[model samples]
Target: MKKVICFLAVLITFVAAFQLFRQKEGVENESYTINLRHNKSYHDETDELIYKGLLWSFSQVGATLPKKTTARGIEKVTDTLWRIDVSKLGFRPVVLEKWRRIIAAAKNTQEYHLYGSIMLNRFVICSIYASNHYYEMVQAPKTYSEFLHPSVNASSKAEYAVEISSVSKGERLIRMDTTVEAITAQQFIAVEGSGHFSQGNFKEELFELIDMMPNGQLRYLIYSHNGRLVNASPNSYGDAGKPAKCMWCHESYLLDNFMSTPNIKGYLNYEQFVSLNKRNNDKLIKYRKQLSTEINYENKKDHELAEIMYISYMEPSAETLAFEWHLSIEEIRRHLAKLRTHQHHEFPFLGQLYDRHEVDKLAPHKSVPIPKSIREPNDDEPNLLGAN
Candidate 1:
């Protein structure tokens, strides 16, 4: 009788442990708490080696690493989970690829390959190479005044001012680089200025571009004076590449308010400034009107231009789907397992992500309350422009 009782107790304990493990397997591997700042930036040889290795790893799978690839911020949260500061790397326009070694240095090459297989799929790398094709096709002007129409003599400044400036230190001198009727991509450049608007002492160190797409839609692009694309500029408010931070201020087109240029002798009068704004705005409206379907601004706002290009492609986790549809995590898991999906562990603790277009089809019939356990952070969390 004593032996039977001991055996029964052992069997019950084993069953309970198995049940607990199964439950955890159905959910995420682990939970994470993320902080939005990078504790360190790469500076030494070791850092460079790590960074280059990460670049090589990404290149192996034909993935275009994120544009900003210098700052390093990866933290092990628990034994099974890790968290990355996407906010810091993105706004600082710094490298978020510092963690490649963590997977590359796995137990063996096969495990490393497995990690790459899961993370480097088309859906996962979409954000990295979203704008590659378009950017590659663009023969950017050596100078904004070169390829754009109605070229300004680099020194010209528009008679416009705003109460809250975009650039960090100096005033912003607006210039329309294209003609109203130009068939090519319309262009605008905002340069840094100091003192009065008319006698604008423009600096070429920082600049912003508003380039028109072939479809007549507008996309913001940022560049340093050197012509290389930077994440943000001291001359403009838009931080993320493609100026992801600038979208809220510029909803569909230009701002309606046209403040008077400073009382400088050569500056355009308020009336002339207003007229120029109207002309530019009119061009924007005309181009946009050519579209039959409504533009999806939310999608645009959620990602940088590079990521926006591959918006349709994503590897979503159960939590991500649950948060997206305002459904319980369990329901999301139930629906996900029923679909054909290739599961892989995504970076920074996006565990068990599904690689399938069928995930997009699992829409909730009714609004379900999203549990607080699975809330997501804003991809483009606000940071002080040029603070880096």
Candidate 2:
């Protein structure tokens, strides 16, 4: 009788353990379901699922963009799917490639939704939860001047000022750090003045001096302020006595000409500067107009129509466009067909020319003409390092 009692007790304990394990697993699976019903950013069931999937994937890969980390990896799981892996120590390229394939084979964008992740300054990670709607804003190209220039006019003076008045006897200028990993894969880049500066004095003059450096080496100038060469960041080329070290990383990233003379941060804004020059501005003007149109279309009430316009003009991947707008691939394809009816010619799947063609049909006689001498900065131009 005692033996029977012992067996029964053991069985009960085992069942309890199994039940607990099952409950934990269920909770873990549902963990991504954020109750954003009351959140303003919420879209619909599809949008919610996209957000959940993106968040879950990010969590799984431990991708957090924190300043001063070792390496980070982002993989496009699909047009509407993505995963990121961030590490303090290192990363695995094979894992990134795996996610890339997974994303590629995923369902079309209409069936899924799109999301994007951007890592900035090795520290800041910004995720566009609703990428289909807002990816253009996130991915908009900016010139070095536009990237570093202050957003507000009032802040411009103080923002770009270099400290000269309050220099301590041995005030050390901190050398800027450059990592090959940090330079590559970033969508937008810029440079800004650092350290405390006297009121109303700007660093544009200093920037001009740095801009003149050979091989477009702008990173070399961050080592000094007020004629004193400060300490360089650890493991940096500056610390290694390689002032022109930026070339190595930039060249590898296919941005060797990013800092070429014509693309440097001149006295005028990019558009303004291009206007004054004798260069052909047709490409620049068209690119800017397209960006403007995308931004305008993002807020349209008829999301389906808005998406149709976007895909027709932008010609993004069907899956990617669908993911961005919370539609399926089939839905996007159907919209493309409708757009093709309006356009006499067959639309190219991926290119910028689609925007001009679509705009001509949709808004006849209303054109944003490129200025004669205005040229848009190349998309791959070197980004300026903004003031910390």
Candidate 3:
């Protein structure tokens, strides 16, 4: 268990800067937090990464402008190419070509590739190639072990985070420690932020709260106003050491079952497949030669045509567009009102609390972009310390 201690003040990203500044303008300008832990700032917003490949991890994001990878749009990089490069992170003295292949398959895109034990520490490392694109950055995710099982059910986006506040004295920050781990080979990667914070930047006060973790017990957790909360435990991560029991399912849960659930039987791209020959011989054979092939040709074509027509031609008129415009105003207002009413009653979390306010003092809004998480983080040793 990794124990983490944190002390936090009213720390807001660039997102909240203006809201805080409007209250007291003309100051020399307040600095913001930009550490490796999960953070969100208007200046260092997320679309920048989503434009790169964020969906593999984060969900329910609402960037002011849909993140655009290129000048105009997004072109999702295909997963068919499992490209993993270990040198990107500079893993170790001992070479492991297999490890690099494992990470390449796991990078940015949300998916899992199981492998038998290869090393002692199981010190799995995830990659996020942070580059100077648009104006943004993101905390790097390590594995499917951390994905399916998260530390906390983030009210917003679940992120391993460090809440940092700019103080006159210096930089004050806090981190949420612990991540989920798999238990056995037959066991699936259970999701949980199960460890404790082993280290972090803290204030003597808010910092002491996490000192109670048992050495290796703390698991998947997420940062929240109170502190990081465990969203999952060992069982969800995999059949491992402790059978993490759930409070709600306490009647049948046990902590010792963790290590006994048995390693989950996973499939290779080959194992989970029915070779091209089995996908409807005639159809697949034909799809292989068409400009745009199809597995469920009829259904897919029907849906595609309707969807395209509706979006291309039948979409609401401008007046009915959410933004105040001239053409379909009333209809749009009615649709939005209905949407708001429906969302308020059912999807409050997905509703409009996403505020992308601007710092009027800053320059014209510019798009922020990020690079792939497959680059070498140690290409330049002099800048390595600063990179983190």
The model with the greatest lDDT is 1
| Model 2 misplaced regions, further than 4 Å | 33-190, 193-201, 204-257, 260-388
- lDDT of model 3 at residue 233? 20
Using TM-score as the measure, which candidate wins?
1
- Candidate 3, residue 348: Cα displacement in angstroms equals 50
Q: Cα deviation in Å at residue 56, candidate 3?
A: 17
Q: Any runs in candidate 3 off by more than 4 Å, and if so which? A: 1-136, 141-378, 381-388
In terms of lDDT, the poorest run of 10 residues in model 2 is 119-128
Q: Each candidate: what lDDT?
A: 0.40, 0.27, 0.22
After the best TM-score superposition of candidate 3, give how far the Cα of residue 186 lies from its true spot, in angstroms. Answer: 20
Candidate 2 Cα deviation (angstroms), residue 229: 29
Give the least accurate 10-residue stretch of model 1, judged by summed lDDT: 367-376
lDDT for 267 in candidate 3 is: 15
Model 1 steric clash pairs: 68-94, 68-95, 69-95, 70-95
Q: What is the TM-score of each candidate against the true structure?
A: 0.41, 0.26, 0.16
- Tens-digit lDDT string for candidate 2 (1-388): 9999999999999999999999985554232211111111122324333333333223212232222432223334444333333322121444333323323322122222222221110111111111111112122212233323243243222111112212212111111112112221111222224332233333321121122111111222222223322222222111221222222222212121112122223233334333422121232233323331111212222322222322332333444344334568687666665453323133333332223234234321221121111011112211121111
